[model samples]
Target chain A: MTDLYESQRAMRAMRRAAIQRGVVAILDVGTSKVACLILRFDGTEHVLAGDGIGAMAGQTKFRVIGAATTRSRGVELGESCAIQETERAIRTAVQAAQKMANVRVDHVIACLSGGQPRSYGLAGTVLVDGDVVREHDVARALASCEVPDIGPGREVLHAQPVNFALDHRSGLIDPRGQIGQRLACDMHMLTADTAVLENLIYCLKRCDLELAGLASSAYVSGMSALVEDEQELGAACIDMGGGTTGLSIFIKKHMIYADAVRLGGDHVTQDISKGLQVSMSVAERIKTFHGGVVATGMDDRDLIEVGGETGDWEHDRRTVSRAELIGIMRPRVEEILEEVRARLDAAGFEYLPSQQIVLTGGASQIPGLDGLAPKILGQGVRIGRPLRVQGLPQATTGAAFASAVGLCLFAAHPQDEWWDFEMPIDHGAARSFKRAVRWFRDNW
Target chain B: MRPMKDPAPSRMAYRMNRLMLTPRFRLFLRYGLPVLLIVAGVSIWASDEARRDALAERVAELRRQVEERPEFMVRMMVVETGSPEIEAEVRDILPVDFPVSSFDLELDTLREAVEEIDAVASASVQIRGGGVLAVTVVERVPVAVWRRATGLVLVDAEGHRVQPLDARADRLDLPLILGAGAGAEVAEALEIIEAAAPVTERFRALRRMGERRWDVLLDRDQIIMLPEDDAVTAMKRVMALDHAQDLLARDIVAIDFRNPRRPVLRLSDAAMQENLTTRTRVYEAVVE
Candidate 1:
């Protein structure tokens, strides 16, 4: 048991440093495309030792050695519609990224956009041996946290003890060996369906990369795009992608909550394709060129020619007003934003600082998106771009790739994971555990 | 009718008496033979080869475990740093003096054999690394320097022997335990000592005496003895009290607050010796 715990601890620590060693790949399965990037970090000293304190300044950084994007195949919306189709797409991206980077990455950190995730806060306490609470005592207290019954067929994705205190004193970061009768800890845990997680892991195994770690797309996107101040002061990053819009909240430089809405840019594209009697490709072109929610005075004369393949030239082309285009796009955009607004409210956005909301994603690049955001998402809105990372190509930095880019940042600096904190092999429910230990000494 | 014979009865009468005298004897005669035969048959079958093999496997596993090393994994890390070479000041301790497979013993008994070595924290000769024997030594992470009347000695909080002070305080943040024989709790005492590392720049020494108590000597002439049952707990309470109220800044000689709930203060000898003062009780907890 102790050996298992240590190995788990080592695996968690290896993730960030391993990615920077110039051998990391990302697997993103979305409805529109199966995107993959093999980031080969190139620099002097790939791993930073002792609290990222290198005075070399900007001399060290990662460069995108390879990249690939394949059309969404065998995937319905964000989740897998069929396993074999998804695997094929992943293989294409992996091969492309590998061919470009000139290396084979055998480890991948995958990100998922859709899952029913709920946030729960738990606190646990353990009595110190005598009155001096040591580091082991605090760890024992955290292990005492009752892993919630997140329902069957679901596995815990993240279990992190964020805060700790000894006795009456709080905010003791590493209370390993201080004396106190009571040591307390606050922990956060995230769970996802075992089937969903297993499917992703299975797909990656086929790609020949070990599943190193997993993160929610919304969570990584929030980390990559939100600035230090935005993260510290509190802000919401809503990533409007091809198949889904990911939402996350950041505070204290950590992503506290993450969620997603199934509706995305594809839905709007479909509305236009069906409304304009055009193919998805043509609808996308028109949406990119003149898609707007709020039609102004200049939009009325927008004479767009509709063409057909038939030989009758007069019947083949018809003049369409810009207002009609706006009419077709506005409702779908509103529906997506409304779904996101509900998720924000559910996440308790009112409690966070600044509460500044930033919208980014493939659809977020639409012309009238900035105007449409405030009406549904409230005030303090802006378009966000991922910043402070190296080795990213300009083609990959768009709002649509927020999750993939944010994944690079996550790969660079992961937060304190579950294995970092020391816990006894058989950490149990605190109250009964204390009672049982004390009882055994007395009875046996 | 058999009693009519008085002193003794005939064999036929005796047999009849045995059957009638005890309720259990009659009951056994009715049910015992079948049960005894069944038990004897089952016992005969149970001591068979299949059962014997299972027991043999269990015994073998237990014996294997008994021979396994009891030391921590770090001690067996292949001695990655040091090298074996012949220099002018020469040492052949690696292959000859302690031949490749010469020593085979655990660390508990060997600690005392090398206690006099100033540079050695603790060492053990072990038979490992593929038939090659090597000395396993744990260097002390020094926390403080302790001075005594007889001599200057280097000791860990647990009372294990260590190297003398090197004046490199910036490199190591450890607390010193003075007096003597603190080795038992020294391993655990390091935890308390390290907790004060961030707060206290350098601890003077933690002195042990009376075989039951402790005193942490900080800067100047201050001495602090810990509680008996939970010394680490008492030290933490003291640290907390000191951090919150600055208890250490005040001029003091000895503190006898072994009881965390009841703190007793003793004035420092510097002023007491000069003015010829007596002991005084300052803060006392009222018993319920």
Candidate 2:
């Protein structure tokens, strides 16, 4: 835990240095595409209240100066499988973005969508040290939370204190300067496979970039896709990416639970390729152009040309009906949503006041998804695009770039995590020092 | 469907691209490099002594071509003055050749040289339009002719020497002040001459005595010695006395008013003998 704290703190310091330089690159190493956005932080100013413009969740502080995307080569399920190939893809995206922005960015904030992220809810309480609760009491209460055994080869990615309760009053976002006998906080910690993280860091290193920060794509996409009210009430953002469908549960504007399912749009593409006996690229084109979840009578009449260059005249000309294509994709997408529903059920998402589910990412663009999603994942499901940002190109303002856009917002204003707080002096090395002092007092 | 080939830049190309994107390096490539190349090329070309000398020679030749244009050439000289002799003297002293470029002329030094002439009070030298060098001179008017031991020289009222005179008859209208250092007191001598207007027919010259006082030399060997401090007043008193008593016609060879309180006269030799005989007869008459 201390080691995680030190490294996360170091990353925070690196992020500070990057923001001081005013330019940072946002790299979303998704399975479908490795997207890079060069963000130039121009500092923040308060907007006038009654002018129909709000704070915009701190997104106004930075502008997306350069954006580029390349076909993901060696990344599978958001983890780099082949180091050199992943480095080449990253180099391609970063070089393109740098050329567009005309600046060299050394610091990068990246997100991963794989690694089987697990969420843990931790609660701890401490007595107020003074008449009014101070920041020190909050840090003490946060430190008093017992760390759960996250198993070997798993690293803590984010540990945010979601809620604070002062005495009888619960759901207090900030407990400082409040009269309370006991200060309690519920913290949400998400951890992922350490090996996957190492691979991502190694790839970024190979591309000559310093890893300033790392975030889960599920949490980031939730930040970008879900509206303020959905986040404030309760919502689950299901990012239907290529190799994985990442889902994160947000309540009171905080991600309380996050999980990823391995079966995704790529599986559907593979299914189409197998069902129609076509190439993977052809299936991908067929999926993007004519893919649907609900098969109507018109869809049955629609036929998509899946051309091939096998040099055999009969083999080259093959066509599949849109109903058949929908037939191939619906099962996979249903399976993914069912898996997300199961995860959300296990997370007790239905118990929340508003159980809104937002489906986003590259695969979520399948037509008739909204009509098909509520059957498996329950009602209140909607297809969501990322929030519009300043200077973003029209081509990139899609569901697929949600994580990339969220990374921009993240770089502008990062939420405080457990590592962002000062560790209570009574823990770790400070305890040993206190022990030594006690021993000296006894001897004297 | 297009081929699924992954395209990426080579490592060296990527590094080079990033290097080119660096702000400092880009600025250097955009501005500094071109300026540096130009300066280096110029310096390298100028490194050879012969080439540098050729360049300098070219510049000098261009300047000479511009200077020697017909419009810039001073073809002749003109002197604006009241006296022709002074103009000739100015032309002689300057000694400038015609059809020379005005650029080659130093007008200020020429003006200083012209002002060095004795009769020229002030001078200005300029090259006028139509290829002419005009020299304007202000000539001094001689107020007195000083009879120095060397010769008589025309001197201005301020006692500045104008020029040498061959003889006194050359400027008879000007008064003569004769003696050592008399040129310096020409103004005072002229004042004394003005005061002795009543004895103008007898006035021959005003001679400086002992370099401090003046002696008015009249015709018929008569002289009036005037005091130094107010010699003009002494001359005026003498003029008044001569007007009332016809003092200049008396048989007195010299009158001394150097003391100013007493007027002393020295009689001529025959006049003294006649004065003694007259005095003896008057004494004999008085005794009988």
Candidate 3:
């Protein structure tokens, strides 16, 4: 736990220094594609004083100078399966973006879609020392939270204070200068597989780049894909990518739960390939151009030729109806959605004040996803696109680029986390005892 | 929800919460900005046009403050190697205001201005210690007095006019040159005058005739026409003959040394009559 806290602190300091130097790169290492974006900061202090009052305060002035996306290689189920091939893919994407931006970047903040992220809601309370509650008291309250062991092979990714209460006054975002005797904090900590993170760090080191910051793609996808009100009230972002479907739940502008399903669009593609007896590349092309989960009566009349390069002309000229293609695609998408629904149910998302569900990512572009998502994932489901940013190319501003664009925003203005504060060093033993008690209170 | 003692307090809290939640308030906080900023920007841009002018003046004032430090100020100007009169004229032509910053003064331009004066041969300007502006001038010295049709002008060895002389006796120590192109030929004329220094009192002036050659005018209206190529040598020889045999003291009116091999001397009337009597007696003796 100390090692994890120390590394998080070191990364936060590095990120701050990088931001001060004016330019940083955001790389989204996803299952199907690798995207890189170069963001240039103007070093304006407007963000420091505004705090959480406005979302645009910190995001008003950054520009994307370069962006590049390439087909991911040697990555299976959103994790690197082959080191050399993944390194080459990363180098190609980063070099192309550097060429476009005309700058050599050393610091990069990366996001990954794998790693099996798990979110925990930990609550802590502390006694205010003086008549007024100060920043250190809030830090003490956050430090008092009992961080679960989360097993041996996982590390904490994000530990952010989601809500605060001072004495009888609840729903206080910042209780500083308030007259309170007891301060309480509700923190949301997300942890991921440790080996997956270590693999990414090793890959970045091999490429001669420094990892200044890291975030789970599910958390960032909800940040960019959901609207402000959806995030502020309650919502969930389901990012269906090539090999993984990421789920993130947000309430009061904080992500409280994140999970991923291994089944995704690639499963549907494989199903089509096997069912139609076509090559993988042709299946991908047909899926992109003609595949859909929802079919109409007219789809039966439409025919798509599945081309093959065999010497037999008749065998190469096989045709399939659009209905048959939909038939192959719908079940897999339904299965992925069912898995997502199970995760949402397990997270107690139905009890939230607003159960809005936003569906986004490359695979969410199926013709009738908006119509089918609500029926399967409950009501208030909408297809979410990434928010429009300055200088974004028209082609790159789609559901597919949500994680990359969100990574840019996250690089610019990261939410303050528990590790950002200074904790008292003398009360380690007492703090541990209190943390154990709270752990029991939270679990049993 | 806790109940408020009065509706006013609860209503105030509700209004504050509602205001904080409004998108307009968020925009106002993010970019629409503090009212002070808008007021400052609009007031600066929309007020009297003199605001911009005042801003420029303020910038210039700040630059002046930085540039006018004690080390950069030129407190005194010292002129070296110039006569009192030339130094005064140098001061007049130099474009510098005393006690001004040296950065404001262009030393190259000052040097050029000082050299433009007729008496200044060359000049250099530099900044010395103790806030001093040192100007060194090499004044042109008068070597000959040119007698022009208008007046007498003192000219240097290079035939550049140094100053205007009031009278011929004002600079009697300098040699006198006469004619249209005498100023340009002052060097050769001075050479001839030096060669004829033995008859310094009898030498009146060197005249440049037809823009070439020299005619030496002596005290008794005797004109010695020297050839152009070896005029200096001819003058030397004439001076030598006059010194050895008192050839110039005799009753000769003119000597034509244009053809050096055949020198001709034109005699006075009395000497011509004596020469006729002597030639008749010599002729009778030769015939007998």
Candidate 4:
């Protein structure tokens, strides 16, 4: 296990990088804000070693030096929708943090909220011509997934042969040299739309930064939000952001599924805007200041001044009871939870051993969200904060910036890079964008 | 006085010089000279002993170093001899405590232990601490046995010796080639259940004659006769054939490709299986 931790590719240079100056950076791109953290990775060598992360604890030795956040431009939900705006936001946050650290980086790994993502479970079998089942047999079984022909312009993001079964036997790890007549494999394949990734790459390129990596926001959020036990037992992280709500499921310490919904906190603000006949700015302010699901007994007499700039003096200072604010926010939060629940149920969540639900991201901090969440999501529900990284500042360590902080962790300690599919030929020969066209196609 | 001193010695000077030659002066030289010599001698002896001890310790240290130096060097040598380019590759994965693959080859200690298993031509073992080991091989005179696609196995004399190396092409001495399941009977071989051993300085290969008789091929490409019925006659026939035929004289092609009776001999491919008449064929036919 200790050896595996060092050899895992994501922490590639982390241990070595930790030895010198102990500095690393994390950048989180969201619809509402772009945040960057410059961590001074110190006191981590021994601490990381204590965690049994030997050898490469060499890389986790910096302290949290500085952090910066800027209002997001054209990024909606998670995916970069507009180049100039997203680039500007990324540059602003990065420059601010770099100025604080007085250092610059040439590479950055950006994460987006959504893409036309799909998951497929595939199984394969090999007739063991030789008496011993070996590494070659495993390779052959994984290779037998067929091209999948996800079409041109799209690429396979992750392909893992998650399970193996020897002849007549099932669920084996490493059948090598075992006298098996046949070998079988089960794989999980994740693919995303090519254009969505291209836009992210382009935005980073505009900042003159190489796209070192790209992650699904939901996956990283799940990594930060889910505890060890919950991750092992099975849990879902529903990251509620301004533009979209990201959902991810973890089992056996690996993310088995990830997805996003376009409906998020912005929708709630819009709902409040239309219902109260107020502008978006007023609606957001009210949502943050007066929002609550469970009204206390004293809330009946509480009054909030609803202001308008119209000429009528009475209309300018209209008063509304605090109960009315709860009435507006409760249904929207419930709707998001309901949609998440439906998605989880469809994914066979009941089969999982643990059904713990964690709500994170900026929108999850809505008061009384935890009390209302369990009723809609399931038995276990909780608000989650990003595990405070070694060198993170107090300002960046909030539940609202969980996605961004988690993004920092993602950049700091990415899980193993996947198969790195060196495809023989481009799947692009097939019809590109046809499947997802119905999504943006109907809207456009 | 600007003048030189007188050459004559005074009486007073002579008297003082005599006092110096008295017993006290004589005794001082005797004791001090001898004592100094003894002390110097002992000091030299002690230094020599310390140097000798230091030298012995160095030799022991060298011996230990010699023992350790070979483990890694030998392992790397095996990898290099097997694959010329493997030196770089082996070094890259250095300090590996385990062999990359263990089963295909193991140092053949137990298998080579049997006295009758002379078929093992040569063997060597190189172990890298990473558990990556290289076992180098040179197979023995496989008289005959089965060869398969999976790997070649060897069979030795006594008609019973069974080993996978018998079929290895590199061990050209083995001629009794058969496929899988064909070598079952030979696996039951005894050292001499078949016959008294031939005096075999020039013996090269042996073939199973129809699984019933045996043929021996000599180094000079001569085939010697062996009888199926009597072990003694086969021996006598083989010895006589060596003497009478002047077997080593001609560059013989085959003693006989077949029809071993009378052991009809041939010199060329054109003469293959020629001169084919003899009483109840004695048995063995071996060609180099």
The segments of candidate 4 whose C-alpha lies over 4 angstroms from its true place after superposition are A1-24, A39-63, A126-139, A147-153, A166-183, A308-313, A420-444, B1-288
DockQ of each: 0.00, 0.61, 0.01, 0.00
DockQ score for model 2? 0.61
lDDT at A407 for candidate 2? Answer: 86
Which candidate should be chosen as best, given DockQ against the real structure? 2
* Candidate 1 vs candidate 4, lDDT winner: 1
Off by over 4 Å in 3: A43-45, A50-60, A310-312, A427-444, B1-288
Off by over 4 Å in 2: A1-24, A40-44, A47-65, A98-107, A124-155, A177-182, A205-212, A274-277, A290-307, A310-331, A418-444, B1-6, B16-27, B178-181, B202-288
TM-score preference between candidates 2 and 4, better one: 2
lDDT of 2 by residue, A171-264 (tens): 9887878898989999999999999999999988987899999999999999999999999999999999999999999999999999999978
lDDT top scorer:
2
**lDDT per model, in order?**
0.68, 0.90, 0.85, 0.63
lDDT per residue for candidate 1 within A299-389, as digits (tens), equals 8898777655445677457657888899989989999999988988988898776989988877888887888889888899999987745
> Candidate 4, residues A223-301: lDDT per residue as tens digits?
8888899888899999998888888888877677776777688888888888788887788888889878878877778
Q: Report how large a share of the reference interface contacts model 2 reproduces.
A: 0.90
TM-score of each: 0.54, 0.83, 0.59, 0.51
What's the C-alpha lDDT at position B64 in model 1?
Answer: 56
**What stretches of model 1 exceed 4 Å from their correct place?**
A1-21, A41-61, A129-135, A168-181, A306-316, A428-444, B1-288
Top-scoring candidate (TM-score): 2
For candidate 2, the TM-score is: 0.83
Please tell me how candidate 4 rates in CAPRI terms: incorrect
lDDT of 3 by residue, A1-444 (tens): 677778988887777767766667888988888898888877465655645432332434688888888888778788888876677677767766776776666689999888888889999999986689877788789988987779989888999898999888888877778897999999999988888888888877766677889999988999999999999999999999888999999998888889999977888889999999988888999999999988999999999999876667887899999999999999889899999999999999999999999999999999988778888898899999999877777878999999999888788768778887777643667778877776888699
- What ranking emerges by lDDT with the best candidate at the front? 2, 3, 1, 4
Compare candidates 2 and 4 on lDDT and give the better one. Answer: 2
lDDT winner between 1 and 3, please give it.
3
